[model samples]
Target: MRIDYVINKVAQTHRGQSEGDVAQAIHDQLRAVGVVPNGRQIAQYANAISALPQLPPNATKR
Candidate 1:
């Protein structure tokens, strides 16, 4: 799987959720797609996603 796809998934599911929650959600999503990622890896992704800057409400893709 692409890193960008994982990043986007993590960002989408991170809102109003704790790190553990995000990790579990990501785990489930990946599992359904046959990618059994390790817990530590998922945790790292969650942590990294949380560190990303939040886009403004009016922000647009360019």
Candidate 2:
């Protein structure tokens, strides 16, 4: 699964929830869908994705 996609989806759907909450939710969903990632793994992935910078559409590339 795409980590970024999952992160964005969880963020959009779980607004107001804590980062850990959102990460756990994604972990649970993945488990239900037959992809098993441990809680720690999920948290690490979530943290990395959260740290990514958000750029606007008007931003120019170097």
Which structure among the candidates has the greatest TM-score?
A: 1
Candidate 2 local distance difference test against the native: 0.65
- Pairing residues by index, what is the TM-score of model 1? 0.62
lDDT of 2 at 28: 75
Top candidate on lDDT is: 1
What's the residue-level lDDT of 62 in candidate 1? 62
Q: Write the per-residue lDDT of candidate 2 for residues 1-62, one digit (tens) a residue.
A: 55556656765566454567667788977766677677787877667545555434455656
Q: For all candidates, what are the clash counts? A: 0, 0
Candidate 1: count the clashes: 0
The digit string of per-residue lDDT tens for model 1 on 1-62 reads 55457657768657446677777778877777777688788888877766666545655756
RMSD of each: 3.8, 6.4
